[model samples]
Target chain A: MDLRDLWAESLAGMLARPVRSALTTLGTVLGITTLVVTLGIAATAGNQIVGRFDELLATSVTVDVPPSSRGPLVSWDAPGELRRLRGVVSATALAQNEESSNLVVTANNLLDPTRVFGQTLAVVAAGPNLPETTHGRLLAGRFYDAGHVARHDRVVVLGEQAAAMLGITRLDHAPAVFINDRAYTVIGIIGDLRRERVLASAVLVPPTLGPDFGLKDVTRVLVATQLGAAELIARQAPLALSPSNVGELQVIAPAGPRRARDGAQDDVNGMFLILGLVSLVVGAVGIANVTLVTVMERVAEIGLRRALGAGRRHIAGQFLLESSLIGLTGGVIGASLGMAAVVGVAAVRQWTPVLDIRLALAAPVAGALVGLLAGLYPALRAARMEPVDALR
Target chain B: MPEPVIELTGVCREFPSDPPVRALSDVDLRVEPGDYLAIVGPSGSGKSTLLNILGLLDRPSSGSYRLDGVETTELRDGARTRLRGARIGFVFQSFHLLPHRTVVENVMLAEVYGPHPRRGRRARAEQALEQVGMGHRTGFAPGRLSGGERQRVAIARALMARPALLLCDEPTGNLDSRNTEAILDLFDGLRAQGLTILVITHEDGVSARAGRRVRIGDGLLTEQG
Candidate 1:
C-alpha cells in the first residue's frame, strides 16, 4: 500500500467525524501545553539563579572573622598575605566607618558621600587598572588618579543609582550626603554594573581605617586574580591566610557573561526536552484510543475493503495514517500553546524566558512518535480483523 | 468465456448450534461468466448461508469450492481474503453504506479494496456510481438518501472493484416495487456485460428476473429452474 493514499483516506475519514477527531486531539494539546508551561517556568527560574551567581561574585573568596575563632581576625595583614599567594594579582582591605566618611567631588558637579571606604586611598594608586565593577561603572569623575590615592584624598564617586537618588542630576554639580551624621561631598557618579542587585545604594572606600569606627580590622578584602587564574587564586588564598579566626571564608570565581548565558541555555534546553517527552506520551495514548475506536466502528468497512482486495498492510496503513494526523495536529497546537504559555507566564512573573532551539526541534518529533506508538495496536487489530465476521 | 466463473462440489456448511445446524448441504452449482443465478429460500432455509459461502465470507464445513479456477477451500485466510477482495462484490439487502461517508466515499471504499491503490480509487468509485445513475448524488451521505438510493449506492460500491462475481443478499428485500425494478434492471445490464451475478432472495419477482433460479430448503438444494 502506498503510504500517501493511506494518509489521504485516513485524514478524510477523520474529518468525517469532526467532533470525535477534534476531541481526541484536544487531549494531546492539553498534555503538551502542560509540558511546555512547566518546563518554561522552570527554565526561567534557573536562568535567574545563574545570573544571580555573578552578582554574588561566585568566584570571589570572602574572609570574615568567625565568632568561634580565637584570634583577632580583623587586620591589614590579610590583604598583604593574600596578594603574595600564587594566583593573586592584588588585594585591598575594606573597612566601614560611620564617621570620617565624606563625599568626594571632582571637576564634575557630581557628589557622592557613601562611596568612601574609610581607609588610605593607596589602593587607588593602582589607578584605572583596578577591576571595574561588573555590575556598575564610573559615569563622570575620573576614578581616584594616582595623586588622589597617594595623598589619601577623601574623595568618592557615587554609582549611577546612588547619584540619582542623591539628586546629583547635573554632570558638573556636586551633591552632598550625611553619613553617620557626618556630611561629605559627592565627587562623581558611577554607571550601572554588568549585574547589580540594588543600583542606588553603593560606596567606594579606600583600603585602610581597619580599626576606625569600631572596625577592629578589615571586614572584607577584595582580591583580583590574574586572567584565567581566578579559580586557582581563590583556591590558594585560604591556605596562605590560614587564620583560625576567619569565619566561613568562601572562595568564589566570578564568572563572566558567557557562563551565565550557558547556564541559562542549558536549563531552558533541558526543560523543553522533558516537556516534549511528556507531551508526546500523552498524544500517543490519545491516538491509540482513537484508532482502536476507529477500528471497532469501521469493522464492516474494513471487511468490505478486504473483500475488495485490500491487504492487511493496506488496512494497517489507513488506521496508522489516521492516528499520525491526529498526533501532528496536536503537536502543532501544543507547540504554539507552549510558546505562548512561556511568554505569558514570564510576562506575569516579570522574568525573561528564553526560547531554546532544542525545544523548537523537539516538538514535531515528539508529536509524530506519539502518533505512531499510539496507532500500533489498533493498526494490528485492524489488519487481523476477519473479513467474514467483520461484514456481519 | 466458456469456463464457469463459480463452481461448487459437495459444499456443506455447518454452524455449531445445540444440534450443530447445517447451513448448506451437498450443494453443487456452476455459473458461467455472464450468468445471473438466484438462490431462493426461507430465512432458515440457507439462502443467506449459500450467499455467504459463495462470497468467500465464510468457509463450508466440508466442500471443494472453486472460483475463477482457484480451489478456495485449500487457501489460507489471507489468501481467501485476497481472493474475496479481488473477485467478490457484495450488495446487502440493508445497503450497509457507512453512514458517515458520502455516497461517493462509500463507493470509493470498494475501489480502496480493489486491485488499484487508493490513488485511483476515487475515479473508479465515481465511475461505479455513474454506472448506477448515482453520479449526481455522489456528495450526499447515505443517511440522507432513500432506501432505494442507498441500495443503488451499495450496488455501485460493489461494482467499483469490477469483481468477477457479484453477490446480492436480498437486494430488494427493503425496497418498494419501483425501486426493486430499478435494481433488477441494473443487474440485468451488469449480466449483459459478462459478469457472473448470484442473488439471494425470497421475493418471487426478484428470482423471476434471473437467468436461472435455485431453491434451498432446510440447508438442502431442492430444485432448479
Candidate 2:
C-alpha cells in the first residue's frame, strides 16, 4: 500500500478505540515532556547562574604587590594607568603601617581607653577617596580631604571595628589617639565594607606618613570592574603597571567563562538525562502492553481482514502504524508541554529562557521510534494468528 | 461450456486431535460460470469446511483445488491473499460488517487495503450498494441498520470488487421470512444477470431456491436429481 493508504488505515484504527489510544499515548507524552523540560531548564538555569557568577565574582580583581626593602617597591601613583582602562570602575594603591604593629592606642590621649574595646593594629595610609573606592560607608564624622594629604595632616579615620575596639563610638569629643608619642585626631569611622572585610581592623592615615615609618612602597592595588571584564583587565593590568617588573605583580582573575558554563550544563543534563531515559523506557513498556491488549481484543476484526485478502505483513503493518501514530501524537504534545514548562519556570524565576532547537525538533521522532520498537512483538503476534482460529 | 470457476479434486480436511476427526473425505466439486448452486447440511456436516477451502480461507489436506484455473493449494500465502482479493466475494451468516464505518464506506473497503488503485473505488462501492438495494441508507452506520439491511451492506461490500464468485454461508439465517424472500428474489435476479453464486444453508426452503442443490452428510456429498 502507498503512504496515503497506510496512514489513513492506521488513523481509522486509532480513532476506532479513542479511549484506549489516548490512555496509551499518555506514557509517551510524560516521557518526552521530562526529556524536553530537563534539557530546557538546564540551559536556562545554567545561563542564570553564570550571570550571577560574573556579577559578584568576576567583577572584583585584586592585584597584590610584594613589599621591598630597596627604596620603594611600587610607585605611589601606580593605579593611574589601570584606572584609565575600560571596564575598570575604580583602582587605588594602599600602604599598611608595619612599624606601628606593637604600638598602643588610647582615645583623648588616655594612657589606655579603660572603657574597653581596644587592640594594637597596623595603621594604613590611604588617598582622599579611600572610603569611596573601598566600598565602605562613613558612619560618623567626615573623611579627610585632599588638603589633608597635600598638607601632610596628621588626621585619622578609624575603621568600624577599630573605633569600637578602641572604646570610642562617638565623634562629639573629636577623639585623638597617640601612636609612637604622636597625637592624630580621629575624623571619621568607616564600615559596611563591600570589597575587603580585613580593612575594618586598620586605622587610616595620609600616604606621606608612610616614609617616616619605612613603609615607602604600597602593598596592593584593588581594582573594581564591570561584569564580564575581569579576564581582559587581568591580562592588561600587569602590562599597564610597571611593564619592566610585571613579574613582581600578581593579578588574580575569575575562572574561565567557557569552563564554568560547560561545568554547569553538564552537571544539570547528566543527572536529568538518565531519569528521562528511564521514563521513556517506562513509556515504551506501557505502549507494548496497550498494543498487545488491542491486538487481543481485535481478533475477530483481524480474521475478517485476513479473510478479505490482507497478507500477514499487512496485518503487522496496520498495528505498527497504529502504535507509531499514537507515539507521534504523544511526542508532539509532550514537547510542547516541556517547552511551556521551561518558559514558564524561567518567567516565574525572572530568568532568560535558553532552549535548544535541536532537542525540540528531535523529540517527536524519538517518541515515534520508541513506539515503533515497542509495537514490534505485538504486531508480529497479530500477523501470525491463524485466520480460521481467530474467526472461531 | 466454460471451464469451471472453481474445481476441487480428492479434497480431504482433517482436524488433528487425539482421535483425528475427519471433517471432509475425498470430496470432488465443480462450479462453472453463471452457476447458482446450494449445499445443504446439518451442523458438523463439513459443508462449511468445503466452503472455506473454496473461499481460500483454509487449505485442504492432500487435495488439489483450483480457482479460475490457478492452482491455489500450492500458492504462497501472499499470492493466495491476492487471488482471494481479486476473485472471491464472501457473505458470512453473521453479517460481518465493520460497525464503525458508514454503509458506503464499508462497501468501499474492497480497495482500501487491496492493491487496486483507488481511482474509481467510491463510484463502484456506490453502484454496488444500489445493486443490493441499500442505496437509500448509504450514509448510515451498520449498527443503525436492521439485520437484513446490514447483511445487504455486507453483500454490497463483497460485490464492490466484482469478483468472479459470490460465496454465501447461511445468507438468510438471521432474516425473517419476509426479508428472506426478498433476499432470495435479489439472488435470483443476480443469477439472471449471469453471475456465479454459491449458497450454503441448512434451511430446505433456502436451498430449494437455487437451480442446483447438493447434500453433505457424515463427510460425504450426494447430488440432488
Candidate 3:
C-alpha cells in the first residue's frame, strides 16, 4: 500500500477504539513531558545559580600579604597601583594590628560613670575604597576617603555588628567610640558585606593609622573584578603590587564560574534525564503492550487481510505505522505540556525560564522512535501467523 | 479451447496429527470459465480442505494445481498472494464484512492489495455494489445491514477486483430461507454474466441450484450424474 493509504488505515484503526488509543498514548505523553520539564528547569536553575556565583564569589579576589620587616611589605599606595590592572573593578588594602583584639573598646570612657561598656574587637585599617571592594554600603554617615587618610584624621567606620554593640544607631550626633582610651569619630556604619563576613563586626580605620595601631605591614589586598575576570586579575594582581616579591602575595581567587556552572548543570541534567528516560521506557512499554493486545484481538482481521492478498510485510507495516503515529502524537502533546509546566514553575518561582530549541524540536521524533521500537515484537508476531490458523 | 480457470491433478493434503489425518486424497478437479459448480458435503467431509487448496490459502502436500494456467504449487508466498488477489474473489459464510466500514469502503478493500490502479476505486466499488443490488446501501455500515444485505455487500467486495473466479463457502449458511433464495438468484444472475463460480455447501437445496454438482465424502470427490 502507498504511504497515504497506510496512514489512513492506521488513523482509522486508532479512531475505531479512541479510548484505548488515548490511554496507550498517555504513557508516552507523560514521559516526554517529564523529559522536557526536567531539562528546562535544570537549565533555568543552573543559570540562576551561575548568575549568583558570578555576582559574588567569582568576582571577589583576596591577596594575603605576608608580614615583612621592611617597614611595610607593600606600600600604602599599592591598592591604587593594582586598581590600574585590567579587569580590576575596585581594590583596597587592609592592615590589622595583631594586638588590636586585646585592646578593650568601650562606648563610654572610664570618666563617664553613668555608662561603662567595654568589648574587645579586632581593629582593621583599610584603604578609602573599602566599601566598594567589600561589596558593602554605608548605612549611616559617609565613608572615610583619601582626604581623611592623607590628613591622618582620627576617624573610623563601624561594621554593622560593631555599631550595634556600641549602641550607635545614627550619626546625627557623631558618636565616639574609645579604643584603649583613645577616642575616634565614627564616620560611617557599613553593612551588607558580601565578600568578607568578618568585616561585618570589625572596626575599620584608614591605612594611615596602621602604624599608630601597631599595624606596620599591609596585611591583605581585597580586589573585585568584572564577571569572568577574577582569574586574570588574580594572576596579575601580585605582579602589579610588588614586581620583586610576587610570590610573597598569595592570591585567593575562586574557581572558574563556567566550570562550576557546567558541573552543576551536568549533575542536574544527568539525574533528571534518567527519570525522564525511565518514564519514556514505561510509555514505550505501554505502547508495546497495547499493540500486542491489539494484534491478539485482531487475529481474524489479520486473516481477512491475508485472504484479501496482503503479504506478511504489509500486515507488519500497518501495525508498526499505527504505533509510531500514536507515539508521535503523544510526543507532541508531552513536549508541549512539559514546556508549559517549566514556564509555569519558573513563573511561580520568579525565575527566568530557560528552554533549548533543539530539545523542543526533537521530543516528538524521539517519541515516534520509542513507539516504533515498542511495536517491533507485536508487528512481527502479527506477521508470523499462518493465514489458515488465523482464520480458524 | 480456452485454458480452464482451475486444473488440479493428484492433489493431496495431509494434517500431521498423532497418526496423520488425510484431509484430501489424490483429488483431481477441473473448472472452466463461466461454469457454476457446487461441491456439496457434510461437516468433516474435507470439503473445506479442498476449497482451501483451490483458493491458494493452503498448499497440497503432493500435487500440482494450476490457476489460470499458472502452476501455483511452486510459487512463493508473495507471488501466490498476488495471484490470489488478482485472480480469485472469496465470499465467506459469515459475510466477513468489516462492520466498522461503510459498504462502499468494504467493497474497495478488495483492490487494496490487488494489481489494480488505486484511482477511481470508489467508483468501481459503487459499480460493484450496484451489480449486486446493494447500490442503495453503499454508504451504510455492515452492522446496520440484514444478513442478506451483508452477503450482497460481501459479493460486491468479491467482485471489486474483477477477479477471474468467485469462491463461495456456504454463502447462504447465515441467511433465512427468503434471503437464501435472494442470494441464489443473485448467483444465477452472476453466472449468466459469464463469471466462473464455485460454491461449497452442505445444503442440498443450495447445491441443486448450480449447473454442476460434486459430492465429497471421506477425503474423496465423486461426480453427480
Candidate 4:
C-alpha cells in the first residue's frame, strides 16, 4: 500500500491499544513539560533581572560603611581621591537621614513610619529620570531645590504609596507630617520610582532634613563613574578606602539594571536548561521503548504487508508517522499545562509570569525530535523484517 | 498465440533444518493459459514448497523457471514481487482475511498492494464481491461471517487482482463439507471463466474437480492425471 494507507492502518492499530499508546506518549509529555517549565521560569527570571539592572544604574557606584565594621567616621574628603581613580568621571557624598513616627499626612489622616530619606538635590544627577514616585503629589511645595538644601528648609516630598496612604489629592495644599515627633511641611511628591530591583517606596527630602533623624553621620557617598566603568569602580572602592575603616566600608554599584540582572539570570537559565535536557533524554528513551514494543507486536502484520508488496520505505514511514504524532500530541498538551502551572504559581506568589517565544517553541520541536529518534530503531526493525519469516 | 503461463524445470529446494531436509527435488512442471491443475500430496511430500516456488514467494535452490516467458529464477527480489503482485493470486487454507477489515475492505486490499493498484477501490471491490456471491456481505467484518462466507470473501480477494495464475494452498483444509462444496462450486465457476487455477490438497475430492492432478511423494512427482 501507499504511505498514507500504511499510516492510517498503523494509527488504527495504535488506537486499538489506547492505554499503551497513552502510556507511551506520557514519557514525551513529561519531557516536554519539564523542558517548557524550566525554560519558561529561567527566561522570565532573566528578563526581570535584566529589566532591574537597566532600571537601577546606567553607570554609577554608591559606597556605604556597613554596621559590621568598627569605623571612626572617615572624612567625606574622598571625593578628590575617587576622581583621581581611573575612569572616574565625577563624585559626591550624599547623606540621608530617616525618621519614623505616626504623622498627620492629610487633613484627617495619620501614616505609619514608612521610610523617609533625605539627599542633596545635586546628588540626584538624573533629576526626575531617577527613581521617583508614581502616585499622588508631594503638594504645596517643590522638590529639594539647591536653594532649599542650602537653606536647610523643612520641606518633604511624598512617595506614590505614601501619598495614597495620606488621602491627599490637591497639589496646591501643604500637608503636615511628623518625623521623630517634629512637624515638616509636604512640598513635592516624587511620584513613583522606576519599577526595578531598587526599592519602589520612600519619601525624598533635602539633605537639610538630615538632623531630623539621628543620621548626622554620613549615610551614603554617591559616586558617578564614566560610562562602562561602574563595575570596575565598585570593585576598587574597598581597596582605596582607608584601611583602618574597612569594617565601615561597603560598595554599592548601580549597574544598568539589565546588565546586572542578566548575570544572575544566566545561572538560572543554565540550571533550567540542564533540567530540560535531562528530562528530554529520559523522554526519548521511553519513546524508544514503546516504539520498539510496537514494532515487535506488529511483526506479523508488517511481514504480511511487505509480502503483499509494501516497500521498505513505506514500513519506515508508517512507524515514523506514528511516533511523531504521539510526540506532537504530548508536546501540545504538556506545553499548555506547563503554561498553566507557571500562571498558577505566579498568581500565588504575586509575580508576573513571563511568556516568550523561546519557551513556547522549544517544547514541540524538542519533543518531536525525541519521538523521531525513539522511532528510529523500531522503524528500521520493521523495515528489515524478512517477508518469509514474518508471514510464518 | 497465447503464452504458457508457468514453466519450471529441475527445481530443487532445501530446508536448512537440524536434519537438512530436501523439500523439493528436480521438479519439472508447466501450465498453459486457462489450465486447471491440482497438486496432491500427503504431509511432508514437498507440496507446500512447490506451491511457494510457483507462487514466486520462495526461490528454488537450483531451477530455471519462466513466468509468462520471463526467467523468474534469475529475477531480483523487487522484480519477483512485481511479478507476484501482477501475475499470481493466493488463497490459503485458513482463509486469512485481515480480521479487522470488512469483506469489501479485505477484497480491496489486493488492489491496494498490486502492481496496478486500482483507484476508487470501493466500486471494484463491490463488483468482485458480487462475483463470489458475497456482495450483500461486503460491509460485514470477517469475524462476523460464517466459515463458508469468509472463504467466499477470500476468493473474491484473489479474483480482485485478475492474475494469470490463481494459487490455492489447501483452500478447503479448514472448512466443513458444505463449505468445501461451496468453495468447489466457486472454483468450478472460475475455471469456466478461463482463469488458470492450481489447488494444492491431499484430499481426493479437491483433485476430482480439477482437469489434471499431479501427485507428489518423497519430494518427487510420481503420478499425473
TM-scores for every candidate against the unseen true structure: 0.78, 0.80, 0.87, 0.75
Q: Residues A134-207, candidate 1, lDDT per residue (tens digit)? A: 33456776555446555655555555655554456665655555444344455666675543333234555333
On DockQ, the stronger of 1 and 4 is: 1
- Which one wins on TM-score? 3
Question: What are the candidates' individual DockQ scores?
Answer: 0.49, 0.51, 0.60, 0.40
Report the CAPRI category for model 2: medium
Q: Rank the candidates by TM-score, best first.
A: 3, 2, 1, 4
* Candidate 2 C-alpha lDDT tens digits along B129-149: 999898899999899998888
Tens digit of per-residue lDDT, candidate 4, span A64-137? 75433444354445555667889766655544433322222332334336533322121111112122211123
Q: What lDDT tens digits, residue by residue, belong to model 3 across residues B84-122?
A: 888889998987777678999899988877667778989
Please give, as one word, the docking class of candidate 4: acceptable
Candidate 2, overall lDDT? 0.84
Per-residue CA lDDT of model 2 for A1-392, tens digit only, reads: 55687777788888988988898888899989999998999889888878877765667777778865554556777776778899887777787645754456666544444455335777777666776666789999988887888898888888888888887788888888767667888899999766777778777777876665555677777777787788898888877776777888898877866678888889888878888888888889999999999899888878778877788998899999998988888888889999999999999999999998898889988889888999999999999998777666
lDDT ranking, best first: 3, 2, 4, 1
Model 3 pairs in collision: none
Candidate 3 similarity to native, TM-score: 0.87
In angstroms, how far off is A204's CA in candidate 1? 5.2
Error of 2 at A250 (Å): 5.1
Candidate No. with top DockQ:
3
Candidate 4 chain B — worst ten consecutive residues by lDDT sum? B111-120
What TM-score does candidate 1 reach?
0.78
Where model 2 places Cα greater than 4 Å from the true spot, the runs are A59-61, A66-216, A222-251
Better of 3 and 4 by TM-score: 3
